[model samples]
Target: MKKGLFIFCFTMFIAFASKAQDNTSLPAKYQEKMTSIFNKIPEVTSSAATSLIDFAKSMLGKPYVYASSNPDRGFDCSGFVSYVFSNFGFKVPRSSREFAGAGTPVKLADAKVGDVLIFTGTNPRVRKIGHVGIIYSIENGEIKFIHSTSGKAHGVTVTEFNDYYKSRFMKAVSIVE
Candidate 1:
């Protein structure tokens, strides 16, 4: 009967709609930002946090270059973030200057370990957004971050968020979940 045929078509339509939902893929950035998308560690269980650290630790001791961001090889300030985020399926900005404006701004008091620290007062001004790092710790009023320095003391290193860093700091951004 016509009525029976209508019911069958309606049911098919509903099934197809649900199926479409399952086929949607998240943006590379959001995918990495999701808390369950990659390998995890105790320091970070969420995908964003884990991805950020993995990106940093993966380059331990790698020499800092002008614009490199490859762990198997070398990395620069922005190259470091771009490489790691892209490695895990996130679309990070290509340059440090562009990267400075990619995340939600947060206050120093409220910044979490996974937050991004932007610095622009060191050498090259924020003509773009220069110098970025991942927050490693925020304990007892002190903040620590990991980044590649290219001054007298260069290379990827971890340092505290003190007057030295504060003076050159651009702003803090929350680019991860």
Candidate 2:
């Protein structure tokens, strides 16, 4: 009985070890997946950007509706950003994808509050910028932003730009300056 148990435990250990190795050394099928999973701001970068971010944050909990730009009626991702920035006196593109080309392109590491963060859709083949968010802050190496999502949260909310987002990240556009 003791010998049998030892063999069983050894087999289990080998199985788990191999699984861990697989994860650490992601195979070809997971190379893109790993890149997405593995994959910041400035100052004078002051009041205007801060105000815009604050305004967007204020709209948190508002419903997310497709193609609507009115805050009270609810807003889609781009609409929410458009509405907020318009209130602050900047004209912006009406769609998330359009914003990809609207402002000066900034490296992801150089993003600041009020910058637009563009992302591709969840599908690997979809390369278009399908979502947008306004940068709020970067803290402890985590970039957080505000946007209205049709996602599980289903409304305007602040979210950490984590691994899932990294996978979809397309570009960052600086609109405040």
Candidate 3:
């Protein structure tokens, strides 16, 4: 079963790698970085990934509170991610910026449930990791993530990885194994 999963993930990685080659919006250097990161994703167990995702989902609709890691008082983006991973005994970084180098990077197209999705701050012009989320699902080619946002949703919500997010996407990472 593990071999089968690894094969499937590798095949998906190859397909996405080819597609990534055509994307010219991101600079060549950044593309290389992403590819390097994608190559380092470790084999992840589905059960663990599912458990983490389920725990994250249970917090749906929780209010968004900046700089907070407490579920009772709400959570900011990184705080929410930190809270979830910590529950599973994973010592993840506490801040979004710190996550850039936390775990093995996974390609966005190959991101799986429980993977961490990192994004630039609200202003895409500033290329720095300022937001984070947990991948909830990828259905029919549409990737959806669960995150705590201060946007229109105003709280912990599942959001589509649409153009808005794509523009700000920095990298995805896998911390579960």
The candidate that wins on TM-score is 3
Q: lDDT (CA) for every model shown?
A: 0.71, 0.83, 0.88
Per-residue accuracy of model 2 over 75-146 as CA lDDT, tens digit each: 999899899989988989999879978989999888877799998866636788889999989887789999
Give me the displacement of residue 176 in model 1, in angstroms: 1.2
Question: In model 1, which runs have C-alpha deviations exceeding 4 angstroms?
Answer: 1-47, 121-128
lDDT of 3 by residue, 22-78 (tens): 556788779778767555544233779878888999999999998999999999999
Evaluation by lDDT, superior candidate among 1 and 2: 2
Local lDDT at 175 for model 2: 86
Best by lDDT: 3
- RMSD per model, one decimal: 12.6, 18.1, 12.7
Candidate 1 per-residue lDDT, tens place, 1-177, comes to 999999899788667645544333766666554434222323434657766776677676677888777675667877876776677677678776676668788987778877778787475433335688878767788888877778655777778888877877877877775
- Once model 1 is optimally superposed onto the true structure by TM-score, how far is the C-alpha of residue 104 displaced, in angstroms? 1.5
Worst 10 residues of 1 by lDDT: 35-44
* Candidate 3 to truth, TM: 0.74
lDDT, candidate 3, at 175: 95
Q: In model 2, which residue pairs have backbone atoms overlapping below 3 Å?
A: none
Model 1, CA-based lDDT: 0.71
Candidate 3 displacement at residue 124 in angstroms: 1.3
Question: Which 10 successive residues of model 2 have the least lDDT summed?
Answer: 36-45
